[model samples]
Target: MSGTAQATTAATGTGGLARTWSSFHRAITTNLAILPTIASIVIFVAMIVFGEIAYGRIVQVSTLSNLLINNAHLIVLAVGLTFVILTGGIDLSVGSIVAISSLIGVKLAQAGWPPALAILAMVLIGSVFGLISGILIQRFDVQPFIATLATMFLGRGLASLLSTQPERLPEESGVLWFATKWKVIDGPKVNDLIVTPGLLLAIVVVLIALFVLHRTRTGRTVYAIGGSEGSARLMGLPVDRTKLYVYIVSGTLAGVAAVIYTARLGTAQNITGIGWELDAIAATVIGGTLLTGGFGYVLGSVIGALVLGLMTVLITRDGSIPPEMTTIITGGILLVFVLLQRAVTRARH
Candidate 1:
């Protein structure tokens, strides 16, 4: 072949390879929203390796159980946020809802109400707040961020106004009983590896979230809206109602998180969920949810929470590391994941 023809052929071949690689990358990233969950497992493995090298017994069943128990609330909160993100919206008020719900639920139970009633009341309060945000954004043309931010303040103020101090729920309260472990597996060593009802609740919520996002028509509509609100609307996809429902679902989940947290702690406080919103957002994002809106996975959020929880455990196990270091590490991971998301998004263009 002539030199010019050879050069052209080489360029064409290179272009084909580049295009293939780009397609593969996009496919993997989009479907691998579940990758974060796997990454969390890998991180745990790495932590175990590091712990074995640094501090023996870091992999003990007691340590793992404690880690899971402590972070169950985070997992639940993350799952709720994932639903909101998948619908191409944000819910900044979940932490506040958590606090408010915790306060109301505990107070009602203390005031001679049945535990079920208190739980219902708490979830109702959360749903109401969510509805307000949804209405403001979907009907009034307000931004989702601004609407949810307003609700965040509203929830926090309500929680604080409800009580300036922590209210301790009685240990004997049936609500607290939900926090106890049921000993499903009964491991031979180190506390039996029992599973707390709170953890099980979180798992159940994750499964439900997965079902809604993947199987339901409403869920598909959510993704369509997120993919393009204008197109969804033009196509008559019930955009406004779908957006409203997304926020409501998020709010209800937040309330459920409050019940889990309150049951586990046996205490409800105005300041109970300070900064928890950031953690939930981070978990959702790190789990591969797009911040620009649309695309997410419940299992990914669970993994993100687990990754964070494991990081905390690792830091605590290492005597040389300060507890505050965990926050810095988490922030770093979130930043990296966000940048990765942006890169993937740009590549699709």
Candidate 2:
């Protein structure tokens, strides 16, 4: 048609697109549980772009593979923490559990025990610790923070007693074999896409968590307890049982994380999991799991793990920044999200 008619049509199309974008933004922002996750995705993308600008090869296939490989254990830990945080509780002992469990498994392997039995024992140790914490909190009315903190010290102390030095896995051990085996894919553009069993294990854990958190009746009860434990009890829900189960799950996953980490490194030590609890908590919070409880997504926590991994990659690429800055940056991000959560909570009321 005429030039003026064409310009008018283009303007109308632009206006329609703008309205659609606005509607989508409003829908996401109105849900406080979802807003932080969306923000995390944005921040992750920005970090990736920044990394590419600084390092020139940050977008390679290997870079992507490393992101998943390096952070798989952390992802598993964060998923577990999400469960506890969803129930309006926290587990400070996860990092210590990781250390102790890994030490136990590695020590057993070094002492010539069967790999399978050693692995089982390591996991059981974590479960037993978690069960103790759960009993203290649910049966004896101990605060979650205090109970888990006590376990944290106990775990670390036990790990140190086992070995002050690193314990390396035997070269011929099946555990080491599982850790090193690669699931290699041949891509058209990339010669080889390498994935580790640890990555696959992390994926499996996430899937199971997704089902438990979103599909099960117990999961709903966990949320209800987080929202209001008194209301949940009044409604005939098994509040104490569900709360105890959440801690058990957290502890079990910490054991799982320890296994993956030790396998990847082929060694274990008393200091193996120092500060990891904080990292898991940060990932959970960044992924949109409210510290106040009752809201979160498993996939969001995975994304949060990826975000942290990306931050590390970016900081490493920029060699001028001190390695210690990573914690500072993470702390800052956590603070901002915590404030955002507070604001959203206030607005909801």
Candidate 3:
């Protein structure tokens, strides 16, 4: 009887071990299902660890505050681009829109216009440009790349026609109010636990985008279109309307980013946002948003912007590394993420 009891116990232990192994395997498979997002998160955390080890001061409250303040506009731009990208469309004109809108708004403010009105004009300008692109693409059947490229040139040219030099905002301008910070803590190590209106605005934009993308029928239609436009159309989705809205969102957000950036800097120039659209696209892609469309998160894009901002901080803190290396590092990280995305896509197929 004792011998029989010992054999039963051993059999139970074996069964438990098999169950544990099976659970582990299932967990790994489930993680791999969203490999790009997981990879992005891992890389972001690794970068933070490396930064903390190298610059000890990187984890300070002031550093954290500055990270958000500096990248707030970029976060907004990336969020906007995520929508466009998720719909299998691209907007190359966002950078140009930033330049033109900022220039126009600043010029108007300098001309004694109400700050609020100027700001509205900036957004309107961007939306109009987007509308033009949408009409060209949807109505005339022009490719997105070509249509946005033409609009990009037009925006840049118009901005340059206004002035190549920087236009400074007036000292009493209300637009600069966006840069005001409210302190949340006081300490000698990092005194400013602060929040700016610009940062708050970015956060609000992100939250709105998250809600629209996940909680609304229009959002699902956007994803369906991205998955396959032909299929989406067959399902009676308003593909054309949704597509137009995406560009308009992208453009309007570019304008919003310009306002935030201009407020922070107190100056707007024709060259204010050169190549920024590329950074926006990079941030969206790095955040685990597939280039092929159909899957992404607005929050992930925000994290991606933070990652890029953190890289700059790390590079700056390391005095030995040339500042020029920042761009190279960014490109390398982007390429690595792209390769990882491709691998995951292949595995799924």
- The numbered model that scores best in TM-score is 3
Candidate 1 vs candidate 2, TM-score winner: 2
Residues 1-349 of candidate 3: C-alpha lDDT, one tens digit per residue: 6989999999999989999999987886665536677777888889888998978877678888999999999999999899998988888999999999999999899899998999899888888988888888888989989999999999999999999898999999989998998898885855568889999999999999999999998899889988899999999999999999998888889989988998999999999888898899889988988887887888888888988998888888888999889889889989988898787667666
Model 1 clash number? 0
* 1 or 3, greater by lDDT: 3
Q: lDDT per prediction?
A: 0.83, 0.89, 0.88
Q: Can you write out model 1's per-residue Cα lDDT over 1-349, one digit (the tens) per residue?
A: 9999999999999999999999987877666544544555576578778876787876667667777788888988887787778777888999999999999998998898888899889889889998999999889989889999999999999998999998988666888876987765666566467678887887788888789889998888888887788888888888889889988988888898898889888999999888898999988787777776667677777777877887777787667888889889989998888877777677555
| TM-score of each model, in listed order | 0.87, 0.92, 0.94
13: Cα error in model 1, Å = 22
Candidate 1's TM-score: 0.87
lDDT of 3 at 83: 90
- Residues 38-109 of candidate 2: C-alpha lDDT, one tens digit per residue: 888899888888888878777777778878989999999999899999999999999999999999898889
Question: How much lDDT does candidate 1 score?
Answer: 0.83
| Model 2 residue 51 distance off true place after TM-score fit, in angstroms | 0.8
Q: Please give the lDDT score for candidate 3.
A: 0.88
